[model samples]
Target: MASNAQRRDVTRERILKAAARLLSEEGPSAVTTRRVAHEAGLQPPALYRLFQDKDDLLDATAEHVFAGHLANKLTTAPSDDPVEDLRAGWNLQIGFGLANPYVFGLLLDPARARDTPGQAKGLLILAERVHRIAAAGRLRVSEERAINLIHSAGIGTVHTLLALPPERSDPHLADAAFEAIARAVLTDEPAAPAQDPAAVIASFRSLLPDLPNLTEAEAALLDEWLQR
Candidate 1:
């Protein structure tokens, strides 16, 4: 015998799957309560019990999309070159936005946007990649700045590409955007003062924690310079 809770769980999954399909095929405007319920073969009232409102439903559907994206991102093993790994992540994110425009649109809505486990995990993955670059003395900017620059540039690239017609889209914009950001955040050589003075400071900052004979406060002061 199926318990009520188990039945509800199954029903919820069915509803979300239908909603996702609707969003993907028909576009964001088609994902209404009536349409979702019809696609799910459930009463509209039943959806109310699961999702508070339309915005809630949209957010959940976006989460469903991100869940899969995050899983795919995790399965790809990291490469030896952290910079290359970061570029790979950028490609993955750009692909996701282009492939799932409906989900991307819903997530862009300020009223519908909120933090999700999937987004948190994605940020953590980005941060780790940036950290690796910094640790390797290849980063000319702070890890946080580099991460933010990559994230902002990626968002802008996706938005700009999506706004144009398919035939009108510039296929090379993504590559160009990444290269521009790389120039701003990275150096050609690793930790060479002549090549990049800030990179040397950043490289030295990597050793701040391990330097012996420093008091806790002194170490704190030097670590603050890493932000530059």
Candidate 2:
């Protein structure tokens, strides 16, 4: 016989799968506790035992959808250039949101996103991508600022597109928003000449030890000069 915990797990998975199917097929209105429970072959009371309420169940369902999107994102082979990697990530995010409007709507809600593990994971991935651009000396702003700008633009783009009827949606909106944000946050080139002086100095300071023909003491002195 299955343990109580094992049975609970099985029931929870069934509820989630059934709810997800309902959400995709008939949108959010069809995911009522009674409907989901019926679809899962469980009693309605089982849903109450598993989830705090309808909102909780919906959040769980959204997390499930986001997990699949994130998995696919992770499998994408990263590009050699950090800027290219950032662009790829942005495209992936926008694509997922457009393709899964119901789930994306729940995931993007500021009220629902707090404390959501799946949403947090998505933000962390974006942060990592921004950090890579900063390390490459291509970021024009602080990493936090870059992340905020990019995330805001992406979310806005998705919401805008989703608000429009499919036939009326502008195909170029996502790319335009991406390019505008990229121009604001990133240097035109990867090299340092266009970078902020402080960022350039900091980047060069990091490379001090690898400088050819520089003694340790000389490199230390150069580092001090760069810091000044």
* lDDT of every predicted structure (CA atoms): 0.87, 0.84
Off by over 4 Å in 2: 110-113, 193-195, 198-228
lDDT of 2 by residue, 1-228 (tens): 999999989999999999999988888888999999999998999999999989889989989988988998988876879888998899999998888899988877777766677778888999878877766777766666788999989999999998999789899999999899988988776655654765565446545666899898998888668656
lDDT per residue as tens, model 1, 1-228: 999999999998999999999999998788899999999999999999999988788899899888889999999998899899989999999999999988887777777667888778888999888877877778888777888999888888999999999789999999999999989988876876677777877767766778999998999987886564
**Residue 144 Cα positional deviation in candidate 1, in Å, after optimal superposition:** 0.9
Shift of residue 84 alpha carbon in model 2, Å? 1.5
Best by TM-score: 1
TM-scores for all predictions: 0.87, 0.82
In model 2, state the lDDT of residue 189: 63
